[model samples]
Target: MAKGSNCSRWVLCSLVKLVFNDAYISTKIHHRQVSPLRRPPTAAIAGRARVPGFGTRVNRVCVRAVISEGDKKKTMVETSKELNESAVESGGWVDVRAVITIRKKMKENLNEKIEDQWEYVVNGMGQGICLQLISDQIDPVTKSGKSIESYVRGWMPKPLSHPHIVAYMANFKVPHDFGCPGAILITNFHGKEFYLTEIVVHGFKEGPIFFPANSWIHSRKDNPESRIIFKNKAYIPSQTPPGIKDLRREDLLSIRGNGKGERKMHDRIYDYAPYNDLGNPDKGEDLARPVLSGEEMPYPRRCRTGRPPTKSEPFSESRIEKPHPVYVPRDETFEEIKQNTFSAGRLKALLHNLIPSIASALSSSDISFKCFSEIDKLYNDGVVLKDEEQNIIDNQFLGNLMRRVLTAGQQLLKYEIPAIIKSDRFVWLRDNEFARQTLAGGQPKQELHLHRMSVEEAIENKRLFILDYHDMLLPFMERMNSLPGRKAYASRTVFVCTRTDYPYAADGLLIWSAIKELVESYVEHFYPEPGLVTSDLELQAWWNEVKNKGHYDKRNEPWWPKLDTKEDLCGILTTMIWIASGQHAAINFGQYPFGGYVPNRPTLMRKLIPHEDEPEYEKFIHNPQRFFLSSLPTQLQATKVMAVQDTLSTHSPDEEYLGQVHHLQSHCNSDHQVQIMFKKFSSKLEEIEKTINARNKDIRLRNRSGAGIPPYELLLPLSGPGVTGRGIPNSVSI
Candidate 1:
């Protein structure tokens, strides 16, 4: 090792002369990169840059660092060897190898970090054009597209000219009521068309194949655009009515807007009038924008996506850009796809345009939401308000904490339930299929309804409610889950209502019952007699304080139970303990497992489902996966969300849980009854944990216990620190 150090010193001096010319060293030691493959004279001329009029295939670079500490020489190496040998013998400065190894490891780590950062930068540049393949059958086109054609089911996967990149997207279920009484919703590519971008079959047949078709996944024979006319239960291939009829007057009115571009005609203010002077608005002749004649005004008829999906009516919201004939960037291969790599100059140019908006979004000092928030706000606003009219009553309105929302499934509006009613509401709302939907899907099992009671009885028993969003979301489930980034159960979450139903519910019930028993045991031991609860001023004061002060708003409510008996005391304590401990554990801790993988719970919905009337429909039929990817979260958004969810779901190192309440034991050690209750409570918690484990192994409860479902361990009584995802904390620790 000592010899190697001396050897490095010997080689260093000679290499400097051999590597760089006298012109590079004598002129100036410039800190710059030059491609090793480029001409030598080019570097000398530009000083630190490549000269113009040169081959720009810039690949590798040469870097140089000058050691200016008295320089390196052959005699110096001999002196360095002598110093090292003398130091090693005396052991004054020890372990030369240790220093070398540490430095080498540091360099390796630095290189690794540098490589990772470089990859991030490179991938970020290609985010718009690049995607990876996931899950292909290898069994080619069979049962998709224009169902009138017979499906043979034995078509083999054939190799195309270029390797097909399958951009895997989140697959979602659409109900029978969606998309023209069910067109392609039940089949492959059961997604609505997005008009933003086109799905292209690049290098298709090495040339244009007369009729466009999805040769990879669907059909090679049929023209995808030409519908079957859907007569008997299928119209326009599968349509109830053409997606929202025309709004032409409003389209022209937008060009001559009331604000600044007001056009006056025939002693009246005509919002849709096209004046002759269509240039300057200051000339008093209101001119229409986009510099077009009256005939060129687009969107004369109502278009499917004339406005965003969030807007229930065609022109319900204030929007001017009625993209009449939506342009589809389909079929033509992107520049990077054609060339197979993005150029440095082109990337720099793109960053030049995007960096400002990206920086603004990330920067705390000047955060901006103009890019995506407006569209998102509209989607969220569709719940109880539309067209500036508030739909929810004042009493029902629970003022928003996070700027808004509904509490669950207490109310239902006509616009919110498109899956049920085509237009107007006729059927009186009922819970006839509610129990069935929550259990074995739409199938009504006779056993499930064995204990069916009146709504009044169910409500009084406190088993009427659900974890929620089932009824609220059934209408938009297809469109909501179809989004590329976000996956939520506004439509499908209703069935998972009770504690005995699903993973969180079934396992959570074990913890709840254990705590309830603990509470009842504690109340019985403390109170002893019914009069003891009345005479105990301390207990009375505590109950009074809780009702009159803690929950002052609900102080006068009829629901408040009279604490005259031990049973009343037991119920209140059990509820308080369950809410703080088991209930919160079921909902809070499993955030990462449910959401960390962006596809499962994508944070953003980049695109909307495309309708059949758009040009994008032509492209979607060719490559469904491309549209799927675009409709969800992009690569960057998923990464960011994963990190946040992971942090949020993590447990603290010094964490406390339901069974491990040692602090309470320390204070209650003097009282034997308190000590006895704690022991029984801890024992009960352990037993509950075993029961949960047994239930997880059970195959009957398919939502959680089945092989496909992740075991419901979020309420599994015990866990260690750091994002365990499963643990019954004693309180809402998060």
Candidate 2:
């Protein structure tokens, strides 16, 4: 038998026994066809198999062998079934055990995977090596708190070589268990001093990081060692003693310190004291002070006392005090006093004598023969000339002379006369002279027809004269007409006067014409009867028309129609006065006073008359013939009274009387004897009144109605009530 066959037979016999639940080995062999092995095995065989000596000693083994083919097949099938059943029963618990074992092993493997992936530590920082500088508990020599020595000693792994450690004190004191993982000091183990360059936290922690190299702690002089050397293991002193050298050493000692001394030292080093001590003790006194104890101390006394006695007081005999009297010559002194005396006396005399003369000359139709002489001189000197018809021929010369005379006369009248009359001395003199003159005069012949014809002719001649001199008069008239125009002319005169040396007399002439126009207009409007209209509506309409005309235009039609109606005539007169009076006097004198009477009174009859008891009328009537003499100078007296009244009524009592004189002078004519005529008329009227009053005394006593009868009625009494039986009393009774 081949070795493989023998081995197969033995394995089958052993499998049969084991399956059948027998302990004995099966020795019998069934005859079966075996196929030859297809290939030899590669590995060397180790064990030898005993092939039962083919049958030599076939022991009586309890081997069950089936002989029939069918039976053998059945036995084999049953054995296979039984073996399967036994295998199932035996290994059933093994599968369950295996599953359980596998689950437990899987659980262990999962746990190992989790352990490799994640980790946990006490601080939030992952496990890593780190270096930290421990904060100092003590302050440095500069008194900077928290020196670095303490830090190095406490947490450095080894002694430092270049110790550059900065010390930091927390803004708030930190607790011992503030969760700081502690710190490490990076240093050379062998070096005596260590320089701390950087600080790193090993774990999740917070700290005020410090570098020892750049800090005051490492800059100490005495204690030069980099590493902190602890002395006794006693509790580091809570407060460091004053004179520490190295702040790091002080820190190592765990001493408490402040920055007061450090600040003071820094201030000293930097010379940062606000005050300086000069070499002079006096200068330095303000900077330093000696220590004081217990009792209060007074302020330091000044080194120098009060100022040295003045030179004058100490040395009395240096200079003499003498009164210097100014020496004035007798002539100069007397002359000064005389001049002052003359100024006062001259003004008084001038006003006393001149004002009345001027007033008289202006009010009278008679010009001084001397004035006419001057006029003749002007003509002879070729300053003036006359035409063949005996009229003023050189219009320019006439106009110029007229203007000068007029202006000088007007200024003298208006501004100077009132001023002279206001003086008591002037008034006394004027009145006394006037009384004397009146006493010498009496009522003279009536020259009415001659005077009236002369006045009319003069007016007609003047109109023609003005036309001839229109060019010269126009500019002068325009300039004098209004304040604005006057002011413009005044400026022009100033320039012209400077350039051409034209005398102020010429300018004065223009001013005189202006005033003349003003006075004439006033007389026509307010003084004459049939006076200006008093109606406000009429006045406003007139004003509107005048304004619309806007600066008299010779070319344009006249704004004022011909004065046909009495009302229109009155308006024209009123307007004329308004322009003449410079608006101011017109509004007050003419409009307010006269206008108020227009509605009730006959305008022409409103003349100023003397009261019954007045001495003026009686004095005039005493010498009526002399008063009425053709050459008598009554105009000045009239002008004096008028000026006095004007001054009393108006606030400007000191205005010149010469202005009034000039106005009257302008009206003088050769043919008209106005001065004598006016005087005669006045004297005659007074006489008539005196005569009637004297005769009616008894009648007045009997009848109360005729008590205060006016002189006008006395002259024409027979025409009215007093002369007939229907006299004043009867008229009143009726």
Candidate 3:
């Protein structure tokens, strides 16, 4: 070899090693995973597998001999040289060329190979539309099969011109010799009816005759391949042929069910109110605009999108605007009381909005209220209250925390007792029998049973026992019962509120075991399809296809690799259960206050924002609206004062807050604070709506330009005709 060629080969080899030997190289061949027993020999001199020579700390030879074009063994260098040369011959980068070749091969494999006469229905825009056709006895002259017009099974792909297009095509007679070639019947001519002026015949051994106007133009019908033609009125025959049939009338009547007419509305089986106001025009306007009438004022209803689906009743309106404001008697006088009563009056209204159950429990005559004290035995045997990370607190800490929250709430209500029922966060009232039984210095087991009885009675009576601090409550119960701590917060809450639901205690082990059994049963009964053979080779082929689709990226970011092992499948199902059961929220809320982090794992829900210019917009949005809703209070409720004088002394109004309150001089002076707060909230909601609208517009624009498919289009019918229900069990445990 010449010196220059030899040097070039040496340089190429060096370059290949530098590029492929690094950690950045994702090729499996470069980073083969070997068994522990068969360790690489170069790894500190134990018996291990290694390339025979040329091993360095940073690099190793990753090439071997492969059979070449003539089935002769070729060294790695020779193979590389040949592949690189072929890539150069094809032009562009080697990877790009390979991708292009694979695509071309796929297209060739997909092309239909048939030997029957086929006709494509072409629209006015020159686009071909397909319909299933059934061919019958062949014509002797054309040697092409003919299909009965009635047996042609397809709805019109789109509206066609009945007066012109359909009438003209029906007048044509099939060519006798060499079979009439496929013909394109043009519809929707000049953006009107599918007129018979333009007809293109293609890919046939012979062509057909057309009759439209009185005149006609004759062409060489024997020629199978001919240029497309647009004939005028001259194409029509002077008189009907003796053997020809007048078929246009039948065609016109048959094509009437093309859905060109308006659709009729059908009555529904169930009478449902048009409650989906977001889509319904009648209600949609009312959402943002208020209705006003004589002697009645208008106000926007509270948007409940973030509230629980179980609650049916609409939230009560604030009584801050009530006709008769509650009077507070101060030596300071009545005028200032009306203005300062704005927050207090609303809080009182919120209390009445509470579901019946909670109202009954809190208002029960037998219930006793107590200030939390150390004598209440609020301590565990060994657990200490500490501000340490991951330190599990016992039931005592929960009780103490509840007391503190209640105390803070009491301090917040500084007005007359009417709003007192709404202001306190937790009502520490228990029925006389339960309080007497539990706090009677009894055994822990007895106390626990008594507590359980109280809870049971409350449930039985449909009375709500609101555990204001459930994140602490459930875990504390788990600790007291000697249950596992990691999933102590996984229990579901039972009580329903505007913002949250009370969780019911659940055993994680039992739940997980049930899940495992269900998954096993489901997979055993339905996972294996008769034709789907998931051998190693098949799986690897699927993986390769997935990777080529641009789905596989760095560390599988933004894409979940197909489940190749039972363990991976189980892990995924575990995550799905965690998310679906809402246990994720329970644990997260328990661990953090006001904020929690969701792990960067695959999720079932995808949120996309097309309007944002940054690629990181989706990550940043993280559904801020939900977070905002949770952080803000939906309703303000008051609590009737218990130990009124003491509570008032401790929570004397701050000068800053007092200064902000509007003074009520005249009876007509309205509580302007409520209006101000409502206006601010409405403005914030409008901003959010604008953002969502902008994103939707961006998505619509993208869909129009074919830049992206709408998310809704990804849905396909889960079950349909020909989707047999056999083999799969009708009832599977879940």
Candidate 4:
């Protein structure tokens, strides 16, 4: 029965091996069967253990032929396959599958954690590097990959590498209701590395730590490649207040220092202590006394440490001091005081210098009245005129003085005279003299006559003196006209002569004649015109007849018109020459004298004495009456005849005709009227057309050999239309 049961077990295992394929387990089970530990010792144990109720051990012995090793090996492989199948049925592979799944999940989780941690590390490393760069420290390595290590090393306190300090930096939560963390690191743009102590972030004693990543690094050198540097130390919290709690996990993580070499933490401890305690007593006292004196002082020892102690001590009575009064010396003696006043020479000099200043000061209307009063006093006191250099105070002096004062004042004080005061106020003061001259009542008759006579006599005397003086100065005048700049003063004399008109007297005529003679003589010498006959044609003809009769320019006969009329002759000759010298020549009739009607007048009656050798005159001698008769035609032409003389009639004289002639003469002489005439004549196209038409007619008539008046002669009648029938002859030939 035991042998049968064993055979059954082997068959079941073989069936199981056919169902599951597990080569590795099957190989392991085959090796175990071949070992001695799996030998039939189990057979001896089976026989010996059979006692009492034990079942009988089954043993089977069969004679077997000798088999080859290869067959033996094949049987062993098959048996091992059966054992492996048995192992699979018992579920031994489940544990191995579970272990592989768990391992894969763990690997994925670890990779994610590494990635997250690397990001934080990179950010922190970048911030630390930037802080070092801003502080202008040389980075240890040129490669960007070493930037994190370099920066961490740079920020450390004295005796501690920057990396060591970074490693030891801590962060904690504040005790207050504020939700911020305890500590922070501040890197400033000015290359300042600051450890911000007692920071009240979120209203808490222990504040959050902030490692700034985005702050710009400002460079110290101007070049682009120069490293940026901070101006101050980095800011980090010194210590946390006692009793702070409820810190965050992240805060704690941020505080953890990266493990580096030896930590020299004493530097941080010293930084937290009061500055006065950091140094020796003598050094501290020397630095502190100046700040406590309340006078201007240097910075105290504590000020170097970020927080300066407050200067809030109250002053005590012991610190007060007493005051003293001041005393001034006084002067005596009236004479001494008077000496202090300006002396005459000094006053003169002061007045001379201050004239301009005073004028400028007075230019302001507000001060002008006072200045005027002062100036009047000075003038009354003879200060302005009594000085020997009074002539120096001419118009130029006053003008320059006023200008300088005004300019100086304007530059110095920016004070200027108002425009109105500068223009009109001074003009009134200088021009209004009537108030001083006018009296309370009319003058006495005798006094008035005396005054009138005195004025008249003064004028007449002055006129006579000027005439005599001009006569004596005539040679100088002739010399002046010949010179250039040398004649400037003489030019002034000429101006006075021309501007001072004395009508109805020979003075104006005499001066005018002299000037005209001088101008004509100069013209004739420089630009002469020979064979120029300047007298009226009638007078010339009469003179010619007398000369032919041997009555003039002959030894037998005397010349007519005496030397007294020499000036008149000169004037007539000068006027004729002046007029005839131009292309468009016309005499101004009013400017010349008339003749014939008043033949016996003193001006015309004067005669020249006869020369020794003579010839008897016959034509004018036989007809002395006829000599005056020849002038009748001229008289008739110049006179206004009454048309009613042939019958008995009463009418007004031809005043209108005479007036019109006067008006025409006046208009012809006026520069304004001549300008108006020329402007109108030039501007009017119709008038130019009429003139051209008339000229064309004249040209055509002349071309056709026809007798016709010239256009110019025809137009001459239109020139004095209103005075055509006046006493002046219409046919008065030029």
Q: How badly does each model clash, as a count of residue pairs? A: 20, 54, 37, 43
Rank ordering of all candidates by TM-score, starting from the highest? 1, 3, 2, 4
Can you write out model 3's per-residue Cα lDDT over 1-734, one digit (the tens) per residue? Answer: 00001111111111211111211111011111100011112211111112111112212111111222321112223533543344221122111000000000111122221100111122211221111111223434434333211011111221122211121111112223323222121211111111112222211222112211111111112111111111111101112121111121111122112212221111000010111222222234333322221123322221111211112223311122247432110111111223344345444323322222232333433111122221111111111123321132224457566446434544332322211112221221222212211112111222223234466575675544333445545547555445321122222223312112111121223233444443443333222442222332322332332232212122234565465654443454444433433232223211211010111011111222223787655644785544322222111111122112122222112111100211110111112332243234334333433433343345333321122211111011011211111011011101
Question: What does candidate 4's lDDT look like per residue over 184-289, in tens digits?
Answer: 2222222222221111111122211222111122222211211221111121111122111111112222212222222221111011111232322233333332
User: lDDT of each prediction vs. the true structure?
Assistant: 0.34, 0.24, 0.22, 0.22
Model 1 misplaced regions, further than 4 Å: 1-501, 614-620, 663-668, 699-701, 705-708
Task: Give the better candidate number (2 or 3) by TM-score.
Answer: 3
Q: Which TM-score value belongs to model 2?
A: 0.12
Listed in order, each prediction's TM-score against the native is: 0.36, 0.12, 0.17, 0.12
Cα lDDT tens digits, model 2, 1-734, are: 00011112222222211111111111211111111111222321112112221112222111111111223224334533442343211221210000000000112267553532221110012111112223333223334222111111111111122121111111112233323222222212211112222221211222122121111112122232222221111111122222221332322222111111222110101101111111122324343333221134222111111122224232111121245312111111112223343444334333333434533444434232123233223213312212321232224456566546544544333322222112222231332222211211111222233223354564554411111333435566544545421211111110001112111222223333433443344324322344333322223333333322221222144554553344554444334322322232212222211111111111111112234587656644675333223122232333333333232223221121111211111211111233333334334434443444454453432211122221111121112211111111101000
lDDT of 1 by residue, 1-734 (tens): 00000111111111111121111111011101100011111111111111111122212211111112222233234433543343221222121100000000112367565643442333223211111111111112331111111101111111122222111111112122112211111011111211111111111112110111111121112112211111111111111133211111111111112323212211111112122222333322333233222344321111111222112222222233344322111211122222222232233223222322343344443222233332223123322222222222233344252124233311211111111111212211223323322321222222333156665666676656444557756778787767654554442222223344555566666777776776676556545677766665434544554454333345677998877777886776567667766777767776665554333345655555556998888677887666655655543354344445555566655455666633211221223555576668778878878887887777775544432345667788789876666877555422
Worst 10 residues of 2 by lDDT: 95-104
lDDT sort, best first: 1, 2, 3, 4
The whole-model C-alpha lDDT of candidate 1 against the native structure comes to 0.34
lDDT of 1 at 392: 26
TM-score of 1: 0.36
Q: Which stretches of candidate 3 lie over 4 Å from their true place?
A: 1-515, 525-564, 570-734
